[model samples]
Target: MTAPHPQAARHVRAVAVQPHWSAQDFVTAAAFRRWMRAQLDMARPHLNENGVNLVVLTELNGLPLVMRGGAWALRLRTFERVALALFLARLPRTLPILLRERVSPVRALQLADIDANTDLYLTTCRDLAREYGVYLCCGSAPTPRYERRSARLCRQPGLLTNQTVLLDPNGDLIGVTDKVHLTPDEEAGGVDLTPGALGDLRVFPTPAGDLGVAISLDAFRADVIGTLAAQGCTVLLQPDANGAPWTAKEGLPPDPANLRDQPEAWLESSWQVTAQRQIPYAVNPMVVGNLLDLTFDGQSAITGPAEEAPAPRSYVLTAPRPGFLALAPWVTSGEPPALREAGRHRAALSGHPMENQYREATLHADLTLPPATRPAPPRTPHEDALHALLRGEARAARPGRWPWVLAALPLALLARPLWRRRRA
Candidate 1:
């Protein structure tokens, strides 16, 4: 049998989902099977595909087990507003909330008694990275802990969630950043869950290529995106939930319905497209759902650069499961696309039957670099007007160069009689 393609052979697609979860204190297997089926159905399109898709779901970061005659069962949870909540979320009262500002040592001792999933979640993510080329991170920075046991929680290996850049066979960055921001629920019980820490912008050295990565949801902010691009980041892989943060209306403040593109959470939870040179910029979002659990929403999507740029091409894509959005190698894409000033620049044309009939670019001495180190900025109003005048003068001086051959080519191909002249 043929060996599988080497790792990082091509683009990588991945996804993550956070199901709206209720506290569960039961160990019944039946309820778990129902939940598992629903999530699997939601991800079937991604799962059924031939290639590996990195699916990240909020349930067990790594699926647990199956029961009975080839039946599947799993327990899924939203990152606990409290860790104990992961298994006991349905009961909010049972969830730990501080009634008093301070607690006795006895209570503190009781808090420490709960089981922890820090290493479990962390290990699952690492395994997924190596196994699926898809990584799903459920829960967030804080997993909820009594204020006192917080230290122990951070001390555990799981307190810190990360996104390792994908590496090529040679250990180069495949282009994507690991999760940097930890949500409150993820860090609820312990650990420092806030966004923006040291090493937020980390570079991974891999044989595929070096990678520059950023994690927070806001890491895709206009400024942040620009900064990362400038810093030599090739891929921006970000994972987010799909429950809220969707758009419900247009041209208004946080659309009452849509949570994704609203104004309120623009900083932490939003995606937008910006073009620098008209190369297509697009933003695509993926929402994962549980067919077994219809109430469950989806997660993990790629919000590509907007498409209104110069090239007039689509920019967003998603697998939403072991899903990924990728740009083809620059060679296939032809020229280095950039955010160009809108004008008369031609859009990219591809693989037409007569594509060769068109012209290819030829180098010219006049194309030499300018004296200034920086590229020339767009022309100012005065410069623009002057350039327009010069263009008009040059056109007038040389008379138009109409392509008479274009007009005759159609006549020769059709070979139809001259309209009224031939009729007469």
Candidate 2:
């Protein structure tokens, strides 16, 4: 395996992909690979110019590919419908895992198809990393740890965790980072994923500098950032998938008088965290579009310390302060009035003609990380307050018991008919 050029050690050209999720993309493993290949193909122009050393994708980018085996489910066209289809289709296989693993049916659904989904995700990423000759952060997925020597799944059942893998240009595994903090939905809201160990956090040394990854909510934690910074990490890669509206009010804005939207909240969590740590550079890639009932939207960005001002570019966000090197263009500022009025009515949102144009974007930037001469500014009152609130929330968070009951209700209802047919 050849090493990346020495120049990439300091100045690295990176691409952050804001992918638009669709069921069609995961109709099959080959279809998923084609979709991924198309993303890199779109970045080929930038890759050809100075050669991109790193490509970052968003959190849960591979989660949808669990539908790879369920082409029938993909055709269902709604998350609930697709999920129901998968649950029924894989029920026989999932039940054994569920009973043995003592996991929720949702988790069993994932585990039932784990080998296929994991293989599809890893193989596609490995092939793409080598083909593109770029260090690929293949985004986060809920998967079990595979044995290093045999590269086989441990099949530990409920031990699935949201993990991100880094691959060198030669398609070899560089390192793996599991998300230390899991969202409420991932933990007890039915996904049943385990929280990663903080001690397992480590940086991957690359030609582009030591790269540290914090999957979505993990990036919002100060301790996670501090851990990476203490380890001499230079580039912070935050792969995110925001489950809420981009322009909606975040939970208890730091400044009550001045409410912050999703973007502002994310900026506080991501860019500001890295900037305060003086981590030179940060890349945030977001997943957009909708899958079934969930709609994800965000503007992906590449940022650096606020002190280093570059020439104004059309793609960069300057008004909120000039730390952004490049920001992906989003079609709408907030939820469309129609969408807001319609609420959780999936049919209305999905049927809207403009919905498909939500814009899956690719943001590229050439970042040069120089040694910080000055100390980072002290945490502001807003930062302190927000951090406290976030930490408090994290501590208070527990897997809700309701989701288990709710998930079981559907399984019982769906299985009754099958049982009746067998009795007949």
Candidate 3:
């Protein structure tokens, strides 16, 4: 075989896409795929120079697609009206999950069509990986347990996790990892997602480097980053979606007294974590824009060790810090003063006319991997038992449904549809 491209052995070209969420883009599966393809198209110029080895997307990039058929709600501008439309549209499927899982309507809706959402998310990523001939990290989605026994997705019920999947250029899955840490909103609030077991954490081998993923909040936890670092993971990928204002005080600040804006806080957790762990590289891609009542904002970045100089093409932020290889421009140059005023009035900024201009961005960088570190030690028996205990607790928490008196109205509304279908 001809000698590999000179940069192939030591370096890999990677791109991080900062996608803007749009209900219109997710109106149909085809629209979602087209939107995904458009993201790559934005980086086509860089890909054309030489094939990029990897492309990273932000967390929950496909979650909004859970609204697949509820596009009619877009016409109703108010959050309450839109949510009610979605609940009614998805009632047939969501009601069963609501009663079975004893969850909020919003969470039930997520599980109601999870299989389709997961399929759309995976197939789109797989096809994109093959078409571009690059390793792809499709970000995370709320998915149930699934297996590929005969090259087909065999889904099973019982456990629902926020999962991230990695695929190679051949459209074959390299690995799948779940997010171990759950944010409060994801755990106790309307989302109510199950947390992944720490014992299941793993590193996947790739041409670029041994890849390890820590979705969103997991990246900030020392235990998660430390475990992966010890496992000889040279490159860390963090897929993020901040549901708060970009300039707001961080909810989980590293230092309460010396609080920072969300971007600075994110950098401390991501870039700083990689540096502390001694990982050669870290790529963080953030999802922006608003979905219903929730708004997400952040600057995507590629980071490395301080000693490794960033490429000339890398965009510098306010204070040029070491180890930041590349940074994507913020969706807005600066938060508009009117946004702050709107916040003071308890108004939803997502609905503002100016919010429609949220821009999507893609940042590219060539990362050079360092020599491998020592292998990680196997999990101890105690760790295994702890993982088992957590899983059991999660299962017990979803025990037989409690009575939902409020669901009677929705059930009555659906009675006509059920009668029509049965008569047919």
List clash counts for every candidate, in order.
Answer: 65, 1, 0
The model with the greater lDDT, 1 or 2, is 2
Every model's Cα RMSD, please?
Answer: 28.3, 11.3, 8.9
- C-alpha lDDT score of every prediction, in listed order: 0.27, 0.66, 0.67
| Model 2: colliding residue pairs | 79-292
Candidate 2: 10-residue stretch with minimal lDDT? 415-424
Give the per-residue lDDT of model 2 (tens digit) for 1-424: 9986554236778888887777778768888888888877766666635544788888887777767767765555555566667776766666666666787666767777776677667778888988889888888888675432122223443688888878778776667788998765566554567898897787666776678888887787878988888877788999988765454444531233565555656776567864575577788988776665566767788887665646333221224466777777656333346434332322215565555445778877787764432333244232232223222321111121222333443456444111000000
All candidates' TM-scores?
0.37, 0.78, 0.78
**Model 1 RMSD in angstroms:** 28.3
Which wins on lDDT, candidate 1 or candidate 3?
3
Candidate 3's error at 136, in angstroms?
0.1
Candidate 3 vs. true structure, TM-score: 0.78
Q: What tens digits encode model 1's per-residue C-alpha lDDT throughout 194-291? A: 23343345433332112333343434444545554554443343433322212211122223245332222432322332223211112222322222
lDDT of 3 by residue, 1-424 (tens): 8976554345788788888776688879988999889877766665635644788888877766766877887777544456556777766566667666665565666777776676677778877888888888888888776543322334354467778877788776667778998776566443557799887888876775788999988888888988888788878999988776555556553444665555556765668875574567888988776665566666788887676645433222235567777777654443446434333232234445565355578887787775434443343332232222222321212223334544565455332211000000
